[model samples]
Target: MAPKVTYSDLVIIGAGPAGLMAAAWASRLGLNARILDDKVDRVQTGRADGLHVRTLEILDSFGLANAINEKAYQLREICSWVRAARLPLRAGYADCDKNPDPEDDSKIKRTERVRAKEEEHGRFCQLGIHQGFIEQNFIDFLRREGRLNVERNTATKSLQLDEALMSDHAAYPICLRIGRSTVTMNGDTADQGWRSPQEEIIKARYLVGADGGHSWTRDQVGIRLEGGKTKVHFGVVDIVPITDFPDIRISCSIHSTKTGSTMTFPREDRLVRFYVQLAETGSEGDDFDTSKVTPEMITEKASKILSPYKLSYKHCNWWSVYTVGQQCAPSFSKDGRVFLVGDAVHTHSPTMGAGMNVSMQDSYNLVWKLGQVIKGIAKPDILDTYNAERQSVAQTLIEMDREMCDFYEKGAGSDAHNYDEFYERFRTFLSGVGVEYGPNALVVPAREDGSRDSRSCTDLDKSRQTRGFSRRSLASKIPIGQRLPSFLVLNHSEANIVHVHSVLPADGRWRLLVLAGDISKASQMARLRILCERMDAPSSFLRTYTPEGDKVDSVIEVVTIHAAPRHKVELFSLPELLRPFDPKLGYDYWKCFANNNAGEEGDFDDAYAKWGVDKDEGCLIVIRPDQHVSLVCGLQEVEEVEQFFNTILVPQQRRKATAAACE
Candidate 1:
């Protein structure tokens, strides 16, 4: 029999992006987690190398994206179109100011407009960094937080769920076996010292099979992978090249008649990654040795693909050849204890460059739900939403990958026949114009038209209008479920602008912002104060105008009041504190204010004109930690806010039978 073992709160197999994110998020939630990977060091190359905007925002929350961004090739521009010899048909990076025309009256949905606005914001642009860099950044984050204890060169030989070891009445077990060992350090310290064959059978309360495509943990749990394999083999090579291709960018896909198709992406260390589509026309057996496809072959392939355009590489950094396939597990969880993420749960072709992005997002979705359960803030059933929500995205990605492959890698005849329509659809998709999320998703609220909820939160308040308010438009708000845009906040105390996210609490929770103009208005102040107390929420109260004799220091901050009619004041008072708001700071005023000084310059008198808030009456707004609107109602009825929160956050009541089973 296998040796008995003690237990840990969580054990994650595989140290890839998904596993790393899972561990890091768990740590943030105050859970002790251990991650095991068979590899000794981060993979130098030959994996995903693109990060989506949403992934970057998620990384920002952990304070890790900046480090990676330092090493990343900021893809500020993209040039796309067909070319004869991989030449630029049209090339230019996307500028921060290329906004859609606001006055152009189109019947497009408000969410679509919001997405366009976000794209205009530019802070959420795609980042080009290799998977290794992302992993290293997460590792560094864990180290700085003193939360992650990862074991490299450690592999789990087996895993088993035991019912007896579980909490007596618990449905999910506390039993999981992880067979671990150490590698040899040197020849001298053999046998017992360095290279010992010591085995560790670890039991974990929760197990995650981040072990990748060929996941051993997944097999142990009897989760069947339900997807087919690809017939084509693709070779990835990393090289430092000396080239004069001015338009060559990260998301470039090149096609050639001479040597099939190849794509290149920028990387650090002056390196470029090449994904070459091989001519594996008819290979019946899996015995084909991919090692035969060397740098020389890749060079030849590149030469053929970029026929007229001179391309050459002097130094080869890394290279690997592997078959591409799309596969996914039927479920993300097993017996409510063992879970799978990233490649373990779903694997897709790399054409769309979404694998890493989706994997990171998976962790983001799971982490918050898991935190709520572990903290007893939410029920365990909430975890079910993980599968309900992410599975469809994974499937959608698979289809997208297939379409990308068909359009980019197929023959000339195929391209000529099906290029235009497919290309247009794909381009539209890449602009992030049409992606939608399910209604039950945590990030986005349900739509009024009864469409499924999507994570994209742009243009959510298209209904709100500002006739004369141009300085401070509602457009400044970052779309819901989208990454919070970064901007400079005037920290009057520090006399310097600070990043907005720097002051926010890292712990994921709700935030209630009260923009009160006169906190001493006995009736209104009492109502507002009572509402704040009842919400069990932290608030930042700023006054627009200080009564002639009132002390400004008592409130969070004070600013000049704008002129407004008495009727407008009765309608809504714009907080003078936000009047000097810096558009460059976007929506990060809280962070800037908290970190900087109380005395800063620059009057935002013009900016406050658009909020429709009269300088006379105070206004209260509630923003979720993810920077989405939970409620915007006035502070009069405490029950309204409470009911809204309950409706959106609390689980619905079930019938007696289902409730009993859940209990």
Candidate 2:
């Protein structure tokens, strides 16, 4: 028979972090997706493992944070060590207090020990878990939801896209020819298990190239990675130590005057990861011969850096070699149909522990938009914003990676080396919380009039425009394009305290929050009522865009937070639109919250003051599905809310017709 034919709403090549994230988002959004990888099985061990604060926040939204917290090792502190002798005058490093002999400069000793910057605030800071465990979580979630499963042992032979059909929303414009392993021997290895292959064909509405740094899909799309690699190479090993290294159980940065530098990561299951700087050998330009390196070699380098403290491993879990490099794609998408994410779009040293975090975030940002367009809930042009937004992030990531590589290579030798200052500068970005998208189809520019500007949204170099009504000042702490900062509040019905973001799950629905200041006052309550009247009207965007016969809060979820005592406001007293009732689900008592200072938790002022919104004049805020703030407006600016949705959402009447016709 001819090659078996299949179809998918989205097809992703690669089952790594990025591809798995894309699959997770697609499954969550109810999209028909197919994820394929040539590897026969899941990642067994040794890859991207560090999870940043924002990434943990994302997992919490999905109800997976607790599980991760149980299994992963928490990294709450970092310690730095250097030569005990009189060192160069680096601002961050003071002389080692633990040095036995003041004049002995030959031994390594502790220089500084400080709390992890990420632990200063936020619900979670940093975690050390194996990449395989993370991937398995995504797999388990997909399987539990009865969604798509990854197709492994499948190799893509070629790909083709019909240019004319690219603009057609209903067309499966991208086509791929692939092969799967058909036979395996009883004792064959992972690579030798496959003998022959059966061919297959897949046609998809959209395609994602999340393969890796050497992405075949990226090459097929004619995109070139722009940048060069650094000459510095590093040997990485994960092992259970057998020696008495002082900070073996803690994350540390050790710099030696003669032996080079080593970074230590305390991981789950008592395993420690050591990244040891390798000395140059007989290697060609730009290429470090990893074949000449081994776990023994890596351990030797690490032992040299440790000095007086003995270091060896009873068991070695994994080992590899890598060169520090920086390269990024000029753009992330081809014709808005074929997109690249993760390492496919950017490549850098793994020193920052950002490769997997940034890569997974790219898919987290893109797939929701794709689901909206595919389901006829949003305009097709919104897909263009994916490139405009993520490419800028990729460029920033490349720059940050370059800086990290430079520090690791040269920080030990330079007198001006200040790791403390360097760490402080990029702490927020490194935690994955400082990322901000510019004005685009999805993010409204910070202007008073709520108007769209004709300037290039993709240019990250331009300073943000600060003109017109100045929405940024309304909530001085909440930047419009960044993730919404979380605070605690009391549930109006149960008087139970909860984090504000726990209510804003990753369900692909826009959030409209009404911060009605001091609702006990007649004026504030009156303003909230008027806004509710507009939201409940027949012509409102909530009704106009939500499909016929669907729940009112399906597309846009309305949540109310009042600056009134929890006991004063009954959940049922809120407008019907805010607490919509259903025959099966009853009224949504969880939608309304009160800023009552319950449990002496001190979260009431945190909600009002930290948000920078006055209790007397409440403001309205719009949050994207990914928890990023899109718009901030006055409570009475109902028209502005409607206008913002009009630019993106399709009317329910037209959306249903389009979806039916496509079917």
Candidate 3:
């Protein structure tokens, strides 16, 4: 029995990166959210400490990237090393000239394992940040910007979800019997912690389980993390190590001859992170207690691994010991109501710092779509895409993590040279920039050599709603189902340069990027005029997706980029529909841009050339709020474009009527 019952639009079960991001986006969409955590406080130290560039860019979209950039250590290069091994240098080792036959030469001679070489490809300088500050940043955003409070020291004891009534627009289908208790405060600053436990029933429309790898929420939801653990063990220590090693400050991996593999990661505030591979001597096949692996043991392990180069530490932040394993839940959501995210859905080795970033991205991809549904701008069917997109990425992560672990911990030192191959192949994945989602309802598949309905848009049969694919040749440079590429485009009116994506925030709005043709041409201008009028129409997606009282740009924003020279175009000459203005703020100068240079700045990005849009005629593209490029078509194919948006964005007018019919 419950003492009290409250309704919330969303209830996030954990306070990790995934949970925080889920709450953040939900808050951004103005949903009633209740985020809870079993822990009394946020992360202290030694959790995930690396954020990829893509994650940072996403945070930048939310205007919260500055906190991490200020607090975290920026790591730019990864130095690599191999143990001393020299039979001779005669093969094709180009450096050895000497030898470099990766496969063939290694077969005959064991080449010299010399000092490490620096890899400059560590571009975009990722952050080696602490999870504590990261969580706090999200908490701050939720509090100040999101206006939502996170309930601490609270845990759900039992979850009961009544089947969601299909027709009920305001129904809270899931019920959670939660227990609230005080977390004992430290005597160093004695305060609260003495409150007795209280039980309450929380009814939520959606439930998220971001409760970490050993997720209690996952268990309660009956989702199985299907995978096996590695026999090898590893330990990580966050300490300001006093070391003689020359490259300790740089991110490096040392494969010692006798001691094993030891990787160093630089952290904020002069602290360094060490991940030492443990030797399985007498403890083979034994179930080891990671808790028993003390700091002394970790230090000794690191000492031996980085031997020859002395290593010791006094001031320590935190340390942990664990065995490597990879597992992914069969599904990310249970009946599309109780969903899992981050470690709850998938757990992998943390060698590349992929865990936290991938988890956060999972939330980034999901909540936007979820927000659309909750806001009555999208159908609930879109929720099915969440599991489809994230699970595929989770599997890719698992495969990569396994390969890296096998090489680092189990490759037996001789395979250290293979690091170059790994780095070359997966550098994009590690950086979080190269992740590509497969095709689904949300992500359209690449079109084969095919034909669309040849019927024109005159006295048309409106029942012809089927969509057809455009020629792939026109979109060679624009990657479908991937994040839109960034390039500078000059604001047509202000003449200021801006990163194409900078104007588009992740606020759950579909961005229609109209790459208009040479608008100075009369024929092209007529086509552009038609496109503008169609978009500004009363029944247009831009208008219908927006609530009656809200602005048209709320759900679908229109931004046009043209290849014409800046000198030839007048800001006022553009049609009102192309550059819609608010009565108070005047016309938006930032919405229209020129592909050509503004002046003698010589910083011309030539986005038209880079994006493969022809100088004479450009194509129209639609980008999802999460930055995924969805549809690409010629300006004339308005029907195909309409079908595309119709598939995703549910018009506001359809909300109540559809709800009533569903019920």
Question: Which wins on lDDT, candidate 2 or candidate 3?
Answer: 2
Question: What is the Cα-based lDDT of residue 217 in candidate 1?
Answer: 80
C-alpha TM-score for every candidate: 0.70, 0.93, 0.89
Q: Considering summed lDDT, which 10 consecutive residues are worst modelled in model 2?
A: 460-469
Best by TM-score: 2
Alpha carbon lDDT of residue 382, candidate 1? Answer: 52
Q: Evaluate model 1: give its lDDT.
A: 0.54
Show model 2 residue runs off by greater than 4 Å. 84-102, 183-197, 281-284, 412-414, 448-470, 596-605, 657-663
* Residue 540 displacement in candidate 2 (angstroms): 0.7
lDDT of each: 0.54, 0.81, 0.74
Winning candidate number (lDDT): 2
Pairs of residues at least 3 apart in sequence or in different chains that clash in candidate 2? 85-105, 448-469
| Tens digits of lDDT, candidate 2, 332-451 | 989889999999989998889988999989998999999999888888878887888888788888898878877776543345355566777888988888888767767766764246
**C-alpha RMSD (angstroms) for model 2:** 3.4
**Candidate 2 vs candidate 3, TM-score winner:** 2
A best-first ranking of the candidates according to their TM-score comes to: 2, 3, 1
TM-score winner between candidates 1 and 3: 3
Tens digit of lDDT per residue, candidate 3, span 437-536? 5354565544752233221212122222365664445556776767777777888887788878788787888888888878877788788888888877
